[model samples]
Target: MKKLTALALGTVMAVSMTAGVSAATVESKDDLKNATIGVQLGTTGDIEASEYEKDGATVKRYSKGSEAIQALLAGQIDCVIIDSQPAQKFVENADGLKILDEPFVEEEYAICLKKGNDELLDKINGALEELKEDGTVDDIMNNYIGDNIGETPYESPEDVDRSNGTLIMATNAEFEPYEYREGDAIVGIDADIAQAICDKLGYELEIDDMEFDAILAAVQSGKADFGAAGMTVTEDRLESVDFTDTYANASQVIIVKAD
Candidate 1:
């Protein structure tokens, strides 16, 4: 009876330990090797997450980051991979969601133009260089996301020339801090940057909000002058469109349940 009691107690302890381990959330990238990773469709996060898909992991793509995050909350996915800036927004709004300390990938954000559109690329690059030199780029980013965030909103430049009619910008407005709707206006970092570029180039800026996956296609198809939704340049994208000089830095991060 004594031996049987000891054996029963050991069994209980083992089961308890196993349960604790199983209940623990992802704490490291390696932990994701066998996990179900959620990502926004056609995003760099989605592209990067594909690498792990071969490692016994599954990738689930949502049209919006919010949808992927919702799936995470509903227990439909083990984790979400998204851009760091928008990840902060989602993590702040959702209880029990936390970003891992280590980032999955670091990337530069740039404007996507139609392939072979060297003239427009040169103009954008030149304007970006000037904006960088004058600190306008930094100011715009701080206004939307940095220390000065939300204190002062961006106002369109009145001095810009509209002779060129409009420079249509393609974007996914669902990504906050990058591009998102405020009231009826689509406004954010990318919008401000596009505006600044248009101002320097003497053109009116117009934004078209659509799925992230379609932004590139819109630019390629001449439906939009450029794509600027926190877009990252990849070799795959390069094959389809030309990108301007990098305008901002971004990272892909993993979001998991806290503790």
Candidate 2:
């Protein structure tokens, strides 16, 4: 009877251990598989998440990161994926948002110019080189991004002159600090930088405030000379339009409830 009782206890312990392991395995897998990820439309974060999704993953696209973040908090999505800088800002300001330690993708941000606009491209490149050499790029980034997040500084490229002209820029006026409506004016880091480039090139600066997704179509249709509302340079975009040498780098990070 003692031997039979001991065997029964051992079997129970084994079953409990197996069950615990299975539960743990399921939890770990579900963290990734069951998550409904959010990303900004027309952003590399969106494209990357769509490409990287495993089986049972759901991806949601929003006009801006703020909208996606809203969805995340409402439990419409399990996670919000956006550029790290904005993610950090949101985490700092929002009640429930937190950035995950891991990044989904790393991407370079660039100005989108019309295909074959070589002269204007050259002037912009020259100014960019000067900015980098003279620490202007760093200063601008510090003024806007400050110590809030990490970003790579701009680099000058050898092929400076690839296109030319007055670059009409289309941007979404809702991405705070990057591009947003400040009272009556559309403003942000990208706007300031584009204005500076226009001043340097002796070209007229025309800015159009529109929806994020519309900017790309405006550029493609020749309604705008370029587009630069924190635009990410990606292979998919390269097929439709041309991007200058990367002016900055950022990554996609998750915004979740702070634990």
Candidate 3:
């Protein structure tokens, strides 16, 4: 009887051990401290993921967010850190990938101009306010990102005077629904918002696409009037350029393998 009882207890211990191993989960951002994280180079995710690097985590930098997602799919990385909007795009198009229920960080998106350019800042902010007040900004965003939460259509305003000439917008066209290639032209929320702002201000709109990291340099060097690539304002960025009033709220999220 003693021998049979001891064998039953051993079997129970073995099953419990197996269950514990199978139940291991990564449920929160804190669980990823030692994970291999992927992020787009020079993005807010890239900036914030560095904090994990200091704590012995490894990071892989991709030139585009899609590249990071591809790496995640190929088992090259444990998870991806990216903006919530773009994360939706990637998750919808891929299998076995999902965004965590908890957001890693929340941020606001805005346009950036050269530091001390209060004149342009004031002009843009004024146009943005009018766009917000009359529901134009929300319309532009919903046009590309969808209006699942609510709905309101938009109407084009009358053309303003073009005496101020052209306003060049620098953007990275990899962020879907915010700034991505539609046919041969860049078309998305930022593109539409910049166009609407130019229309309101009476300036012809010109979009310039380049590497995401090159946008700030383009604005600062006078190559572009401003940047509107779903960019989030950060203290490090503030040192280089001033931001207009936030036009949209965004979040940084973690993409991990689905349980």
Candidate 4:
């Protein structure tokens, strides 16, 4: 009877431990197989995480990365997949989450315009190349991210010409340190970069905020002149619109409960 009781106690402890951690802990990419994942709708993270669905994983989509993080805090998801910079920002603000050291995917951010719009595309590409060459792109990027952040903000030259009329940029404003709302204004790395591009090309810049998923469609339909919300170049996206030369590099990362 004593031995049987000891065996039963051990079984209970084992089950309790498994239920507490093994069921929800995610330490690596492979662990996503059949796991519950959270991601912002239409993001590359969502696209990649959806692949796990074939392995029985269930993916919950949210409008913003912050929403997915909130769902994580509520125990509604086992993990969140998002871009590295915004993931870092979210983890800094949230007490119980951590971005895994392993990166999920590498990507390059670019500006998108409607297909067959080579005239605008070529002009934008020219502006982008000049920006990269003169370090304006680096200044804009450093101002929002990295050690020089907030110390190297980009400003439009006082003598910039705007005879080319206004160019509307479509973006999602919920992504912080990239493109997010600051009071009534939208600002971030991507915002400054777009402004610089417009300044170089003699156009007045106008920003239009919308759902991340809808930015591409807006550009494709000519509702917006371009899309620049930290958007990446993917083969799937190429079918709908043409992308400019890459302006930035980013990675997808996994966020899990720290404890």
User: Which model scores highest in TM-score?
Assistant: 4
Model 1, 1-259: lDDT tens per residue?
A: 0111211222322232222122225678897778888899999999989998888778889898877776676666789999999888877766788999999999999999999999999999999999899888888888877676766555667666679879999998888788887668887889888888888888988899899999989999999999999999999999999999998988999999776
lDDT of 4: 0.85
Every model's TM-score: 0.89, 0.78, 0.86, 0.91
**lDDT, ranked from best to worst:** 4, 1, 3, 2
Q: Give the TM-score of candidate 1.
A: 0.89
Instruction: State how far residue 129 of model 2 sits from its true place (Å).
Output: 1.3
Q: Please give the ranking of all candidate structures by TM-score, highest first, separated by commas.
A: 4, 1, 3, 2
| Tens digit per residue, CA lDDT, model 3, 1-259 | 0111211222322232222121113568886677888899989999999998887678889888877776666566788899998788777766688999999999999999999889999999999999999888977777666644225434446656788899999999888768887558877789888988998888999999998999999999999999999899999999999999999999999998786
Q: Tell me the spans in candidate 3 whose CA falls farther than 4 Å from its real position.
A: 1-26, 148-158
TM-score, candidate 4, is 0.91
Taking the candidates one at a time, how many backbone clashes does each contain?
Answer: 0, 9, 0, 0
Q: Model 1: which residue pairs collide?
A: none
In terms of lDDT, the best-performing candidate is 4
lDDT of 2: 0.67
**Model 2: per-residue lDDT, tens digit, 103-206?**
76788888887777777677778877776687766666766687633354333344444244466899986665677664577656787777667656666577
User: Alpha-carbon error at 77 in model 2, in Å?
Assistant: 0.9
